[model samples]
Target: MGRKSSLTDDQWVEIERRHLVDGISINALAQEFGVNESSLRRRIKPNKAEPKKAAKSLQALAEMKVEVDAKAKHFAEQLGALPFAKQQIVSDLARKLTNTSEHMASAAEISAASSHRLSRMANQQLELVDEVDPMKTRAQLESFAALQKLANISGEMPGRLAALSRGQPPEAPPSQEEVDQELALLLGSGGG
Candidate 1:
């Protein structure tokens, strides 16, 4: 017969609960409960069927929630302390960014759905290539190319929107009149 366990039934239950349900490490539990690590492992029989729980306990989640709430409150207080004009600018910039993000998300969803549908259609076309007319395949390829361009535009839209929100226009080649004026100013200054 095996040696009698020094721990009570209630203590064993608590240890198993902490290890399996609470996701606490056996070593840590042993250290906390002042029991031998190997002995604790032998006593606790983990169920093979049920998946292990996440390491974070309910108490930990509660503490994290409190910390996040405090931080958000502090941030709001800081934002409220800002001058009205600065606050307005901040709010406008936030609104612009949010709109840009929504547009990008919508574009992404459309592109993804279109791409998936095209892929399925393409697979079917490949199987029917010998029987189907070549014109239909060409049209499908063109549609795919258009979708790719749309995806590229969607990827670049955020940066373009951000630049516009910051009051910077997209760079363009200088006009001939502007270049002439610059040249004249440089020449006039050099002659003096």
Candidate 2:
């Protein structure tokens, strides 16, 4: 009585009867019939109810994930062609390969067991590369910034290595860090 619909009054009544028997939503019924959901709701829905919009959010998230995946794949493909970016060269003759093993680990058969072992080895390597070497007081493993300032001031790589080997911190050079450490030591040692 409120508005006209494509389906007749009898069809609307039957649709409502089916909806009751099936216990399905009017939107679902509309989707099943490939008709406008709003039109179907107006035609068949007897009880006024608010349709939830959660499905739209989930659909949007799915679309966002797809877009992210495509972008990542495209960037990875572009990066695959640039080989020089993957290696760090030291001493002009030796190069350290950085994570070329993603290809190996990505193999369809890199089992969880293998991954666990690989993770342990990787952690050990990271520690070795990042730890301050006790034998080499040159601060090679302390942090890259500290090492750079030491290299710039000392102008003697061999001496730096000797310093690191002696377990002495490479702090003789005038790094802002050294100044801060001096300040802290002075303040704490009651010399401030």
Candidate 3:
């Protein structure tokens, strides 16, 4: 290599998330993050083949769901024959599996809804041809606020899912003081 890159793994991940998920442009991300435009473009190149892959993945998921349902039914039938402790264990596992499946379905719905909303927002913005400052419109501002809220929920979802899988309550949000301290550290470190 000719030289070392200053960006960290987390920064690269954030860059990818902003570009891929938030639909931020490579040019804007490079200027905001002080990175090479070409490098950013290469790193976050869109996967045109993903729709096909996603279709296959969905098929696989459907097959897996059928298998899981069969197994769960078998287990439920056998649950009555097991000892009390084992029955309790099986019951708990079944409950957890059901919860996880529900969560997965909910997440998929949210993701689809978010994609639809984003597309609608993009179309609305494009239709504001006569407006000098489309972004300043009240509807646009409300849309941005709603998107920000969705982003925050999306960011916390993985942690919530993990907690649910572990049969634990989701962790509480950080206190304002804790958030301030973290912000100070980030600022001190130039946001890594």
Candidate 4:
């Protein structure tokens, strides 16, 4: 008797495919796989044809038909289709309502939380505004006033210099009367 072969079933299937599907010669396969030509031929024999379901016996066909009909009848009687369909619609509506309510609740929560956060942020900004040093503001206002006074003095200086260059005495300081009249006009009182 020939020694048992170490090749697997998959290997045998590949050898068969190469011989039958690829149309390789069996002698070549026999030589490559180191198997006797007769053994290789036996291993590559065509598979037996499976029995066709369409070739069922009359008894089996009758039994199957009875079972299918009985199942159909049972399903029709037990389903209570109209009520089951209505229940399905109600269940779907209930799920939709639950989802809508949950979504609304989440939106409301977000709105409320955002509003609270915004209010806190606004308050913090107001607090920061309040924290501004009053002395700094007063210093800036005083500096602005000083700059305005300096600008007025500088503007009159050129006219004074021109008068001095023409050998005329520099313009005399404003008289108290003239100063008083200008102050009255600026104070919205009719100039006296």
Each model's lDDT comes to: 0.64, 0.52, 0.67, 0.60
Tell me which of candidates 1 and 2 scores higher on lDDT. Answer: 1
Go through the candidates in order and give the C-alpha RMSD of each one to the true structure: 15.0, 19.2, 22.8, 36.3
**TM-score, model 1 to reference:** 0.39
Q: Pick the candidate with the highest lDDT.
A: 3
Better of 2 and 3 by TM-score: 3
Candidate 1 lDDT tens digits, 42-110 = 556433343232223544776899999999899789889999899899899999999988887677666
Better of 1 and 3 by lDDT: 3
Regions more than 4 Å wrong, model 4: 1-82, 128-192
TM, every model:
0.39, 0.22, 0.28, 0.24
Q: What is the full ranking by lDDT, best candidate first? A: 3, 1, 4, 2
Runs of candidate 1 exceeding 4 Å displacement:
1-57, 130-192
**Which is better, 1 or 4, measured by lDDT?**
1
Kindly indicate the candidate among 2 and 4 with the higher lDDT. Answer: 4
- Tens-digit lDDT track of model 3 for 38-112: 887655553455624533564688789999999989877788788999988877998999998998868866765
